[model samples]
Target: MARQDTPTNEMSLRWTVCGDRDVTVRGAEPGDVSALRRFIDGLSRESRYFRFLSGGQVGDAVVSRVLGRHDGRDIALVVTDGEEVVANAVYVVNDADEAEFAVVVADAWQGRGLGRRLIQHLQQLARAAGLRGMRGDVLSENRRMLAIVRELGFSTRRAPGDAYVQEVSLRLAAVTREAWLAHDWFQG
Candidate 1:
């Protein structure tokens, strides 16, 4: 099978959160380095740790390196609100034809369903790129995240050698885009 190239065209998903707030999630660009930095720096200490899986200052050097490769490849997506990034998600494809994913939503934006939207968008992008599956490692304490992935058809297991971490994976081939999007969290 011929390997598929990463998606190149730009697609924007606009959604209204909290009934009155509007936001947009789209492909992360190289110019987003500074904005990305601000977004990371704005994350509460706990949020940063949850996203990075460790506790330490997320420095410019690290942000720059991350954006360096996020230039329209490897599936990087960000949700922006009026000028700042409120959420970020990415899924890097591996040799096994699966993409390892992660998502971080701003503390203030938590509980508004931003993380789920970001992951769903990332899955769409990855599936379009021919990835067979998507997976993420979540800290055991993050019950909300675990529940979200489970509701999206991802199966979870204890990460080998790490009891505190849960490895969750979804078989992208089994989910049709229409069906996936139809599982909208906005529905009451």
Candidate 2:
């Protein structure tokens, strides 16, 4: 199979965290399994709980699934400091013109605005891929994530049949357009 070009800054994404920290946000490559594993391994139990709904160490099977290409429908991204993965995000397109996503940032990097940047990148990627919107299910207790999504203007509600989870979604055109406007405003 031929390789597709990974998403890069040419796509209008150049994320910087904490004002001066240069963070490279890009699509995950097939060869990044090891780095992905290391990143997951570094997550604290509580962080893993919020991310995977599982505590303690992340399983090998879960790692494998995360690293899979999934027939090109999965768009996985990572934010790295030099060569270390500090955060990760992914969205898998469903047949209903929407994609579901999950994002996790390392504990140390939690308050540095990386998650927002990753979501913005995903919104752009989803629009370019012709997706209508992106969605995700966050634990009801994951207030930080819920608040972030709310701040990003996602429409959210309790998931059907699951009071313990909340569903979040944003229209691709709406979000990516908002991001573009913010980018241009910053440039001006």
Q: Work out the TM-score per prediction.
A: 0.82, 0.82
Model 2 per-residue lDDT tens digits across residues 21-50? 766777677778899899999999888999
Each candidate: RMSD? 8.7, 7.8
Query: Roughly what TM-score does model 1 have, to 2 decimal places?
Result: 0.82
Task: Looking at model 1, report the run of 10 residues with the lowest lDDT sum.
Answer: 1-10
Candidate 2, residue 33: lDDT: 84
Residue-wise lDDT of candidate 1 within 1-188, one digit each (tens)? Answer: 11222232456666778667777767778899989998998889889888886667887776765553653447777788988898888777777889888899999999988887777777878778878899889999989999999988899999999999999999878666777778978653
Q: Alpha carbon lDDT of residue 175, candidate 2?
A: 52
Candidate 2 wrongly placed segments (more than 4 Å): 1-14, 68-70, 173-188
